[model samples]
Target: MAATARDIAAELRERIKSGALAPGKRLPGEPALVQEYGVAKETARRALTMLVTEGLAVRRKGSGTYVREFQPIKRVANRRLAPEGWGSGQSIWSADLNTRPMEVTKLRVDVESAPDNIALALNLTDGARTLVRDRVYVVEGEPVQSATSYLPADLVRGSAIEQEDTGPGGVYARLEELGAKPVRFVEEVRARMPAPDEVERLHIAEGTPVVEIFRTAFTDEGTPVEVNRMLLDASAYVMEYHVTS
Candidate 1:
């Protein structure tokens, strides 16, 4: 009896999960698999494609497919926004993956007109400008999440929040110093297939879904000070929220 595509995929899947094929390690190419397994080209290709669609591996153009190295980052809702979290110059992310090194791989801050949806959320007039701080968060060298934070232009106009680095604490801390501390937050989450741009940016596998987190930060007086929209690779994160009665 010959090994079918399913059988090949099963063996490869086991290798991947068992760490025999380490993350970032390239897998046997189609030609090699076809020759080694005595299978047709299509059968070998189908087996590899199965792993790609399973989110266990990704095929880089011109390069061979490799196991995905992404580790799901836990985003804990409660502690991440607490004043004591980022306020002490410690990254709120430190709470999520304490020892893993994370990076802000991309940062772009500029003023832009508020889109209608953002306008409504921030109580801004249509076309009102805002200081948008865009960032891409990478864990262990793989991009996991991208975020765009919109702050009233006038509020952070000349503040450190407008700079590339928001100092030691980040935006929330800077907001507090500017007299517009974020005392309360509202967030809405949705999941769907990644958009073309998101797929490109996050390097997600085809058919992989993304988690969108739209968050609003308000001052103690109920004024909306910031609206941050975050896009996360669904397979790369686990959203955590605490509940209390």
Candidate 2:
């Protein structure tokens, strides 16, 4: 009996876990796998494809498959959202990156009609105007996340939130100045396959999924101030939440 493609892939996966195949090290090519496993070329190819889809390996154009060099960003949900994190003139995102540099690119600020769902989240009338902030977050020159925020136009019309740079503490701090500080937040998270546009924007590979987060920021009085929708590369992030009893 011949070993299946999955059997070969399982062996490779174990090697990777054991550091026998270190990050960036090339995996055996299809020809090599075929000769070693007595398997067909397609079986060898499928074996490699499995690793690629699982994010355990990467395929470079014109080169063989290699173990993925993974240093995933740890996203600390609770700490990052805490008032003390961004309230004292710091970026909320700083909690996640630590010393690692995270760049914001493709920033676009505009006043647009809020989608029905967003409007509802922000407690606005249908088609109400919103100040929309859209941007992509990159680390090591790789796009890792895209975030779009919606706030009532009337709340942020003349504020620095409309600017390309929101100054020291980003939007939440600015919102505080306007008397709508976000003292509480609620986030809903889900994972799914990326859409075509998302695939292009985030440079996501086929079969890679994305994490979608809808975070609503609320004032002390429970008035929702902003609704932010974020799409993160699943392979590039390790979601961390510190729960308290």
Candidate 3:
């Protein structure tokens, strides 16, 4: 008896999850798959398409299909917390944002042009040069979040701010080190469909939604110092915000 598409897809998915087929590794071509699975070309194609829709594989325009790396999605609750005064109260700096107590595996800094939306949020002139920091927040030796933070190059370049690598701290701590204390932050939250790249990077299933957070941090004098956009997989994590009034 011939195996169904679902059966074939399930076998492939198991292989992917079991590490038999590593991420970023290319799967056998359709002709090879057809021969191996004893299926027709159409059946093999359908199986491959199913993998793509499930966020397990990505097909580039000309490049062959590759297994998409699985990135865990974490949920953080959004709540208003008691405002901490300067040099008072426990801060997020004291708590590890890595959640699973994982070490920083990768840190990348690049000079990049700002997207229109980022430019508007940061009040930058169009086509401005921004220092972008890409970090993968890992937990228990696995990637949980992939973050890309943008800043005015003039504010962080050639400073110790870029030197520190790992600790129980965040970008806010680095800003404080630079004498720019962030006193308050305003966050805007929404949900949207994940882009193709996001779908692949996050390893989210089809029809799954993502939470989008836009955060604007302010200095002690109420000047906007930083704007950050965070995308989270809704199924794996939730945002928690505590408020005291």
Which model scores highest in lDDT? 2
Better-scoring candidate (TM-score), 2 or 3: 2
Lowest lDDT block of 10, candidate 1: 68-77
Q: Residue-wise lDDT of candidate 1 within 121-154, one digit each (tens)?
A: 9999878999998989988888888999999998
Candidate 1 vs. true structure, TM-score: 0.83
Query: Taking the tens digit of each residue's C-alpha lDDT, what string does model 3 give over 61-167?
Result: 67777897645433433322223422343334223243345544457877788888777776788888777777655554444455677776667677544554522
Computed on alpha carbons, the lDDT of every model, listed in order, comes to 0.89, 0.92, 0.67
Q: Between which residue pairs do clashes occur in model 1?
A: none
Q: Show the colliding residue pairs in model 2.
A: none
Per-residue lDDT of 104 in model 3: 49
For residue 204, give model 1's deviation from the true position in Å: 2.4
Residue 125 of model 1 has an lDDT of 88
